[model samples]
Target: MKKRLPLIFTSVLSLSVLLAGCGTTAKTGSTATPTTQATAAATTAATPAPKKDAEPFTVSLRHIQIGDAQKFRKAILDDVVKKTEGEIPGLKFELDGVEDQVNRFTKLPAEMAANNPPKIFDLFGGTGDALKFAKAGRLLDLTPIITELGIKDKFVNLSQFSLDGKVYGLPIGGSSEGFYYNVPMFEKYGIKPPTTWDELTAAAETLKKNGITPIAMGSKGAWVPNMLVNTLMGRYAGPDIVNQIPAGTKKWSDPEVVAALTTFQDWEKKGYFTKGELGLEYPDMLNQFVTGKAGMMFDGSWRSSVFKDPAQAKDLTNKVSYIALPGVANGKGDQTAINGNYSNGYGFSSSLKDNELKAVKAFIKNLYNEDMQVRGLLEDNLLPSMKLSDAAVGKVTDPIVKQVLESYKKAGSVFSHFDSTVPSDVYKETESQLQKLIAGKATPQEMADAIQKVQDAAIAKK
Candidate 1:
């Protein structure tokens, strides 16, 4: 959802295998053995006796797993919190849940600027977020903690969170951006899942003509529209364009990139997205789609679990399906490349006291492991960010998740969202330009030129 940098793996092979078949959907009741247990005896020989009664301390943990849709992820976090607290002498986690867009675009950046972020918080990787903070010495280098946890090699890609060979954060899960459509709505209209650009537009027209919003969208956060825009850009400009732009080898104002923006703007002019989408929030988009107000929605694969949860999805339970955006005719890039990202996750503040460090260590130990990774897949529909055992991947009864894996398998390659590849200033510029474009205040050429100007300055600064 946010931007990131070149992750550890140059290719998507690691995640491709993970998506092919991995992890269980079964809920686990196991409590993690204290990760520090092995070193306890060695530590006891050199350390002073601990006090029987320790002063209570609270570690602030800012997270984005808020709202009904995130309940499952929150439950997993609650379990880890419980286990971590049990192992710490007098530690308590002050969990603060905020909306994803606000946490990523507003609150977290302000906190990072003030050098007073919560002890642990949600983070995005790339030049704009984790890497930027890491360069400024605001984010803790998690290299040693991951190593001590014996999970340094477990993650599929850490490059997004790595700076100069030091790891800064760990992705919670892998995700791909695509369309999540209403199955019954498609059937009611006799429209099949669109796999070609013409078919996709035809389906939209069919739904729109029938008085249904063709696409469920919330533009209050530019990141929402940016998702579709990024995929389209990948189609027109080629998957390598994003990487080339940051290196000063390619320009954002390229004809193909502008064409992508133009295509998104065309959808806006056609009134394909929900009315007053600019006034709605991310959750509202999901609400509209789930209630049959819209025929389709472009979103991340992480959302697959929502359709399975009755409380969250309501009547939409077992009624939703997913599809990758159809390939554009005469597209320049790999038409089958899908948007995949392992860029969003938790990061710790660089400044921490002894007890806070211990809390951080315990948090990492309890959270980033095979068990929790599988739990994320099973309970939340999140693809595993860490490696699972050969026996871990089992029968996945959730059709939505199975479809997500199938979409990945069908893709010719995985292309990252541009936000993760560009400079933070350039990324913020794209967000601003996109909102303006959506509001009819800017043209596709204007948007591309504006973004390129910022990119030029950002590159000069380097």
Candidate 2:
């Protein structure tokens, strides 16, 4: 979800030292002490070192460094480049950064289609992006090195980035979604973090009576609201239920799915969210929650960095906590299985092979160690794909992020964001109709029917 697309450019910079000619000049008649040994040594001292016979290998990298992701790159990616300076002979990096996520999903594949993919590039870790590349034979199979680096055991949800029995990539960063609540507000209102449908309603009612907005949300982007709605769907249907839709075993019209949408509708009817939400921007919604105007905001784990900023949220030192949205009265989904996945990461291009692959592996090994894990968790609000040791986990300095990491560890399972792995048109339709559903312009049934039409069309074309 956080992966932003950028302009595509091939990273091909080949550098070799300019060979210097030996400074020794032979005279035809006059001999200058027969070119003394001191003169020869001086000539040698001025000569440049011989260039490597092997051409400089460029590991082309494409990533979007927006918001605190820039901090992560400076701390991790930039640091990797700095640390490996002269460490690996003939190794070079071309980190092509995109400022936003505009072309990453659509345009990246075109680069791959041309048979000139980056040696290592950013890939969203879902069936939609990473899996598509793997299925097309565009990505390098990391199976041999996955075990060699012990990355298999260190990471969670590696299967999402794997196909068949081979791994294709690794998500350096992971994400999850839940209600980010104001601790002091909850305590001041004598309210508790809810764990069931009725409790959540009661809490919302209590907050409403006190003139506090129960939830902070904006629908201008459509995605902000749908993310929460997806979380509700996960609560009603099982964690893996969405897979059935792609498999043609379930319809969006199924009662369980409809019930989830109905639940969201009920919440809207009850004044649980900020008024005029459809027009409000997502940043404004988060700002409201962070500044303590609302009881909570259903948002991604990526927001941890914002909350961690003292200038952004002065009230939130240790006053924010993350928890899953309450389970439904008769829900089938695993309550612990909230919305999450290894949403984005780096994958090797298929062209890197044999000895070249060795440098890639070494760089990755050096990249995902304990120091990067600390920065990812504490500074950048990212969860490391690798498991942290007890000592390293203890070093996580932010209480709110520590809480999120603990939730991540205790969760039963995770599902990819619904729109992420689905086809582009279907995702757009679902997001648009969801905005309408919350606006009362579309019924849950209408929305489901509309989505099913798109789904069926996609399936037929396939």
Candidate 3:
């Protein structure tokens, strides 16, 4: 979700058509074939033998692995490989591992620029960085191939992935951050999911009274704290405020931001979070919630997929349910202003060989085919970027998916999170200040002032 510079298209016609329909299939008939003509044979004969293959070349893919890859090997990866192979007849795929989110941000970019870079990379966070690469002529202009394949309409949220009206990446799925609670625990305590800020606090108080932790949060990652802050801002000041902060039209020291931090600090003081959460890792915190040691968790939709996976989380699936973050009662913000964004997807490198480019387009088109999209949703609990009939989603039992889709349908607008849109330096500083504020080491005013100073400096740099 980190924001990078907006990409500029080298040629308007080259990338403009990439942002069209969300269900059109790619045309396969017109794709160029790899053959050695007299002129090509002359060059090919002189090329190093190590770099040449007898058939269409294979593309190396670097994928971001968030959970247990072994579990999804057969279910997701293997299937994708088989499909890609069938789509791009003679082409092959070589897989590489990206262990976690941090690696995707810090290591993947440098790796991509090296000689013999991976042809396809799974971009994490947002398409901003991918767009930057595209603008720099590092990513292929997929518009022509996508149009030729007639699959331009198969992508969803194309507008979000476009820079200066040109599309640079494809959105695979979407996600939202919300609260997941234990239904049996709620039933046992005769407590209901919170719908408003007052109700949320009361629920936490009730849980405390019953000797249960109110929330299971992991603060070691720093981003977790930012998530809570952004959600609180959405609840109090509305989604538009986030946009204003990034555009320099509003200061971070606004009273609304102060109120949000005050509320978070107040909750921390009241012992709403798990004890010693600051020292706990994200996996440990998630395990605490899944094992029934905690009553609720604040996380994104990806976690919901975990619960639904019988092999991964059999115990937690049947007992879980999700609800939107509690709204501020009669507040300015709408109840549906949930924090969300498109998930990781595919992008092509501009430096791809002619044959490799065709193979890449064919593979992407096949991946977004209706059958595959439905399979991805039903098997992976991933909402497809391509359009699907309601029946295709009928098998998804995860409560969070339904809630997230509904939230998307009703969202008046959506905005990226603070850490996601702010400069890296400002984002890191804000995260540190937020941690300090939560630890009772910094006052709300002090935190607000620190954020304001960083924002001012960032603006001055511009």
Candidate 4:
């Protein structure tokens, strides 16, 4: 079965504000001495005029900063909302928080199809998301806005959110996927951060023997497991394969791609992953690692925030370290290339009223500036999507965040996640087929073939 991405947009900012004015009149021809009249005139001149009353209005915003793991991100968003509302009179933001997957795969799509999406909402970039919505004329074109804001060149990359000459969404931050290990657990087991495939597997075997889940995983939302598989695909098939498949130069069923799936399947058979991962949610994976039930987890750099906050990570605070996945023995292409993504962000509806458009503009100005981007880096462990000065990047002191930056610096190259490279049909097939592969109901080759078929059909349509 082919999967379609119906979800259209992800909005980034929202706010509510209402301002009213009041004033008192002075009596005409008041009898007073010159000194008293002069004093009154000075007083009157010093008093600021009251503002005009504004009609209350709402700009509906959809977001994915939900759960304990997302509290830091939510805090940054809350502050932005307050500032935006303060600047935009009579504007009220109706925020709707949803799980990332639900908002991306369910609600947003339906609303988009109905041509009634929120004024602003969370969105992803790629053929399936921002691009698709742009084609349907459902998303607001932000090219002029960014230019007007004088931020057109500040972004590191806007390719994902741009189509031809117009821009649609704006990425909030950048992230790279890799291994986050329990520092104490590795020390206790006499394991060093692996620099090669053999060492990685050896460490996993050691942990499994010691009754620790080697890799914390949650597959209930297939996207969780797909993260590791995507990196693995990068290793075996090469980074370019992501773009190649969509461009018809390569197929998902290519042997190297199938081998990547087999690698994951082999891990499953050897009991390297959390037992019953298929039944667990994303948060469960984090809980397993932070609680010391697992020795390692393959996750994004954004997760470092959880370990930095004691309220969220508890005893695990300051006890976690991140590293790039080691080079595979037979890996092809630039083996040191790591997965980096700047595809997720917020977008706006094209059908906004004049006031709503003003509100959206104010939201963008408030949220995507230097201060907020720096706040995201310091508070949420999210890498800046826009360019930061050397002084700004120098502000990073967190050990885990440092490691993330180091890994990126050391990488030979960077590749994007396939979810952002391929069309929704093909990406969705990979997710479902991966679950089937994990359950032992489908062979790695079978999974690859299924994904390739979907890819072919999608390309034909294009």
Which candidate tops TM-score?
4
TM-score of 2: 0.80
In candidate 2, which residue ranges exceed 4 Å CA deviation? 1-59, 68-74, 89-94, 113-119, 148-150, 352-359, 406-413
Better of 3 and 4 by lDDT: 4
lDDT of predicted model 4: 0.90
Candidate 1 at residue 457, lDDT? Answer: 94
Instruction: Report, for every candidate in turn, its global Cα lDDT versus the true structure.
Output: 0.89, 0.76, 0.71, 0.90
- Cα displacement (angstroms), candidate 3, residue 183, comes to 0.7
Q: Could you tell which candidate, 1 or 2, scores higher by TM-score? A: 1
Weakest lDDT window of 10 consecutive positions for candidate 2 = 9-18
Please provide, for model 4 over 1-462, each residue's C-alpha lDDT reduced to its tens digit, 9 standing for 90 to 100: 223322221121111111112322245565554445556887999999997799899999999998888888899888888998998889889999998988888899999999999998999998888899899999999999999999989998888999988999999999999999998999999998888899899999999999999999999999999999999989999989888989999888898998999999999999999999999999899999999999999999999999978887889898999889887877889999999999999999999899999999989998898888999999899999999999999999989889999988999999998888888778888899999998999999999998889998999997
Model 1, residue 401: displacement in angstroms?
0.9
Pick the winner on lDDT between candidates 1 and 3.
1
TM-score list, all predictions: 0.87, 0.80, 0.80, 0.89
Clashes of 4: 13
For all predictions, the C-alpha RMSD in Å is 19.4, 12.1, 17.1, 14.3
Order of models, best TM-score first: 4, 1, 2, 3
Ranking by lDDT: 4, 1, 2, 3
